[model samples]
Target: MTSTVYAPHDHHTCITAALANAKTLCESRGARLTPVRRRVLELVWQNHKPTGAYELLPQLAQDGFNSAPPTVYRALDFLLELGLIHRISSLNAFIGCAHPGQEHTTGFFICRLCGNALELSPERMQDVNTRLAEELGIVIEEQTIELSGLCPSCQLAATTAKEDIA
Candidate 1:
């Protein structure tokens, strides 16, 4: 529910909490978090950046998994279906959902420089959806709003560089 990518925090704690939450959600929902699926999730959470399927394939292969396209695809499908991960349309990459097991709209703030992605709270996107629905009279079934921009750190660095040049 919170965006922590731009903020300074414990990376290991975030990953550990996510994995634990995922395990609990899967068990409660009667879904099996298989070894491959679990590993894929871990790989996805390696950083706050989005990772493409092809990028993960080689990692899986190096980790002793089958590494076939179908195998990886299936795991991704399962993760997506469970709402454990989200695909960024623009990047064709996947990122772990900060808030799962809840119905909500997700927005991504992707850093153009570092490739870091931050998940915006659903409430932040609801306003846009409401306006569009009212104006276009269309129902939005699936939503993945991605906005490309520099994150706080990147912005600061850019500003610092400009200052030095001046």
Candidate 2:
């Protein structure tokens, strides 16, 4: 099935929902989601795209938080532990996990033309693991699979340009 590009959801609601979910999960596990760490997560999810640590440092500082690299790294680590975010190894950046309540693997569809990232759930990613395990005799533990290509918007623009020229 083809993935449809979705309308931008309410950012305020997104953050609120994510924070609420994280808080509930933390409480259930006796984990604490501190203020600084929460702010960092907020910044990372401030934009739908993947965010680099360096990019987030300045924003954190601007918000009266420490701008140190370690501070951001530590916060990122905590969030990762809580399954609130995932690192995009190819980009050396981080993107918020789409599903927050349950533990699941995620796959990314990154648009080369627009840099927009689509987060897919574990169910959508099952085939990849099945194929990899069968073909390579490898049992996968963790994965951050990203497929890069033009997104629908860019494809539509290219098609329109070709039609206009014709």
In order, candidate lDDTs are 0.89, 0.80
Candidate 1 vs. true structure, TM-score:
0.93
Highest lDDT, which number? 1
Q: List all candidate RMSDs to the true structure.
A: 1.5, 2.7
lDDT of 1 by residue, 1-166 (tens): 3457888888998789879988999999999998899999999999999999998999999999989999999999999998899989999899999987777788989999999998887786898899999999999997768899899999999999999999
Candidate 1 clash pair list? none
Q: How close is candidate 2 to the true structure, as a TM-score?
A: 0.86
Residue 112 of model 1: what lDDT?
95
- The numbered model that scores best in TM-score is 1
Model 2 lDDT, residue 15, Cα: 71
Off by over 4 Å in 1: 135-138
